[model samples]
Target: MALFVGLTGGIASGKSTVARLLSARNIPVIDTDLISRELVEPGQPCLNELCQHFGPEILNEDGHLNRKTLREKIFTDSSARAVLETILHPQIRRIAKERAEQSATQAPYVLVVVPLLADPKVQPHYQWLDYVVGVRATPAIQKARLLERPGIDPPLADQMISAQSSDRERDAIVNEWIVNTGDLTTLARQVDQCHHKLLMLTAERTSSE
Candidate 1:
């Protein structure tokens, strides 16, 4: 069986960066965010449901999902966020599981990237994860990185960062933590070390089986 390792962190904490590095090393990384986007594509059933509840304004002129508009609504409205999660989480979880299972057949382990693994709704779905890896950075670093993104102002950046698990809270749950306070070279080194450790663990598990 493939060992499932969850990779999660706060907003702008370099979870994607770490996942990219792992992918480059031939490790399978299942990114749930990408799967979520696919689920709401132009003709998907979830997109139709979203339009029915949130209205046509949720789509752009090209008839694609207006992610910007949806982001604004969810961030500013708690109820809207809750309702949207209600529609998307289950589908995303199902799809993610299917992808992870497929990936497992091809690799000894799989890294599942979930931005909100700490969220209550999301946490339960991933309880079966064999291990969790949390990428962490100081609040200042997180805020600065978030501000660099397009359409993200100070308040929204702060809001997004604050919405997820605290660094402390995440640290408590993850089996391993990667601190991304420095440059990419430093972060890469950390990722390499983590990857080596994961490989060792995988070898042990496979041998036992």
Candidate 2:
């Protein structure tokens, strides 16, 4: 079997940057965030279920997901958030697994980017991962990065950061850490190290088998 590695981090923690770096090195990466978005496209079963539960207001006039409206609803209501997760998380995991398996045909191992992998509720579902790497930045840095995004005010940015797993929590589960506290060059160097480590692990697994 091909080794499956998980890449995860909190909001604004540079997970995308790491994934991009890995892709640049010719690594095969299956990103759950992208899968989740695809799963909710117009006429998809996930979107249909979401409309049933959250109402049609969650969709824009063009039939795409009105993310802002859904975000406001979920952030204010825990039960609503739970419902959304219930409808989407399993589908995301299923598609991610499928893509990873397909990618494994061409790569020694597959990298799966799961933004919420450290959450207690989400962690159990990913036990099959052979390894997990976490990208981390200080809370202050996370807040600053979040606030820079369009439509992200101070209060919403803070709320989003607080809702994710803490650095300590992530550290407890991740096998490796990539600290993203500096410029692109610094982040790129760390990603290069991580890529080399993953290649070593993949070779070891292949030889053992």
Candidate 3:
């Protein structure tokens, strides 16, 4: 089985950067966010369930899932959020498991990156190594990173970070961390080491098998 790395981080915290570095090394990554997006396609089972749970209002004029509207509703309403999680999490896990199994037979290892890896519940079934890789920047630095993304507003970005676990808590949970403090070279080096460690773990398992 491929080593399942559960990546966690706050908004604009460079999880993508670390994932990209690993991808550049030819390693496979199972992104839950990507799978979540897939499950909500217009006529998929998940879409049907969501429409039933959330009503037809969750659909766009084109009859596709209106992600924007759904996200807005879920974010503000705790019950809505719980209901959506109840609907989406299982499907996401199912897709992730299938991908992980496929990857295991094809390669030595694969990473399952979840944005909210510290959610305490709903973590993947794989023996996932939680990683709290992120930018150790001040609030101003974080705001700059968020605003530089073009469409993000400062206040919303602030709220997004505040909504999740603190950096210390994230760091405490993960097996390792990659500090993205404007030093891309250092970040790249660290990710390299971490990637090999993951590969080594997978190699060990492969040999045992």
Candidate 4:
């Protein structure tokens, strides 16, 4: 199987930036965030299951997942939030893990960017990863950057943060930690370092599959 590297971080912690840099270097990345979105696409099984559990209110009139409405509804209800995660995360993991395994036979490594890898509840499902990448950003930096995200409300952003694992908790599972304590250029430099490390690790994996 491919060397499956789990790249994760807290909200606004530069996980996406890390994923982008890895992609730029021709490293294939299987991001759960993207898979979650795709799984809920109009005709997908995930969308059908979510509709049955959350009702059509979670969808826009166009039948797409109305992320805003769902965000508010679940974010305000702790149990509902967990229930949603229970439903969506399973499908997201299934697809990402499958693709990652497929990639291993063709390449040195596969990057699985799961934003919730640091969360205690989610980490258990990812122990098979060859490495775990922890990303960090100060609360101020996170809050400031989050304010500018498309369609994000400050309160909702806060809710999202509340749902994530703490930085202390994040540090526990990390084999490699990417720090995002500065500008984009600095962030890119750090990511490049991590990318090099990943490349070395990938090269070390035998191609015997």
Candidate 5:
């Protein structure tokens, strides 16, 4: 009877930080990004589909995904990105759901960190989610965060940010929003408040069931 909360946001919007804080409080968090990576490892079926579409060059000498190449390919080409999403999103959602269900046995509520919960194609599949929390930040902050990453230039960072749904779009659908444009202390305070609220909601849900 655990509530499923879908935590999502734009890239570099501090979703991971929020997830970590929730986990520290003994709440289970299932990350879809990690699941996507796992499904693309050397021998996975998703990787095989990727290879068939993007070709062997998309893999490194070690037969692992050449993430840099693929990232560049998809970000620059919308069609390629759509194709890749078609191949991976379903599988990632399936695994995320499975993991969240497993986590429900251990926690009062489960958090599923989904980066594309706002995407039209991906949103419908997540109807099981009882709540959607958007971790948001100003575009400037998101760009700066992306720039801090290794090998990411301003233009590339901008491209990556532009590739995802805007903050307004995410804000429109989320039940609650976490603004992460300030310091860690501020973000922590928001997380704490959200945590308290979720706990109350979870208790109500459990009692109703």
Candidate 6:
């Protein structure tokens, strides 16, 4: 079995950037965010359940999920957000686990990017992960990065940031930390160092097994 590493961070904390850096070094990654998107495709059961709970208005005229509309609904309503998590989290976890298992045969280790890994409700479900790596950035940096994304404004970005686990919370659970408060070059160096550490850990685990 390969070492299963869970990568997590708050929105705009550079989780995706770190994942990309790891991918560039040829590490296999199973991203729950991508799996979540796949689970909600028009005809998927998860999408059907979402419509049942949130109404058909959440879907576009083309019958696909109107992500913006759904985001607006969930961000404003805590109950709605919990409902969304209830519907998608289990499915995403299952699929991500399956993919990680498949990738283990082809790589020294596998990275599973899960943005909510520090959530009290979400963290317990991912206990099978061998290690957890938290990517962190200052609130100022996070807000700036979030504002750069399309359709995100200051208020919405603040709401998104406030909804996630804080750096201290993440630090409590993460086996390793990647500080992402700097430029790409600095971030890449941290990733390189983390990658080397993971490789060594993987080799140690393999020999023991």
Best candidate per TM-score, number? 6
TM-score of each: 0.96, 0.96, 0.81, 0.92, 0.97, 0.97
Instruction: State in Å the error of residue 89, model 1.
Output: 0.6
Clashing pairs in 3: 2-109
Of the two candidates 4 and 6, the one with more favorable TM-score, higher being better, is 6
| Model 4 C-alpha lDDT per residue in residues 22-128, reported as the tens digit of each score | 88888788988998888889999878887898888898889899988788878799888888888888777788888998777765678899887877778888887
Q: What TM-score would you give candidate 1 relative to the actual structure?
A: 0.96
Q: Could you tell me the lDDT of residue 27 within candidate 5?
A: 96
- Between prediction 1 and prediction 5, which has the larger TM-score? 5
* Per-residue lDDT of 37 in model 4: 85
Candidate 5: worst 10 consecutive residues by lDDT? 164-173
Q: What's the lDDT for residue 34 in model 1?
A: 96
Candidate 6 per-residue C-alpha lDDT over 45-94 given as tens digits, one digit per residue, 9 for 90 to 100: 99999999999999999999999889989888999999999999999999
> Mind giving the per-residue lDDT tens digits that candidate 5 earns over 1-209?
88999999999999999999999999999999999999999999999999999999999999999898899889999999999999999888889999999999998899999999898878899999999999998889899998888878898888999999887888767999999988999999999999999989999988888
Alpha carbon RMSD to native, model 3: 3.0
Give the TM-score comparing model 3 with the true structure, all chains together.
0.81
Segments of candidate 4 deviating more than 4 angstroms: 205-209
Tens-place lDDT per residue, model 1, 1-209, is 78899999988889999999999998898998998899899999989999998999999999899887898888888899888998998998888888888899887789999889887667888987899999999889999998888888899887777777797777666899999999999999999999999989999998898
Clashing pairs in 6: none
> Candidate 3 lDDT, tens digit per residue, 92-158?
8878878876776666666677777666665434344433334344556667787886545666566
Worst 10 residues of 1 by lDDT: 164-173
Candidate 3 runs further than 4 Å off: 124-140, 148-151, 204-209
RMSD to the hidden true structure, all candidates? 1.1, 1.1, 3.0, 2.0, 1.0, 0.9
Output the lDDT of residue 11, model 2. Answer: 93
Alpha-carbon RMSD, candidate 4? 2.0
User: What TM-score would you give candidate 5 relative to the actual structure?
Assistant: 0.97
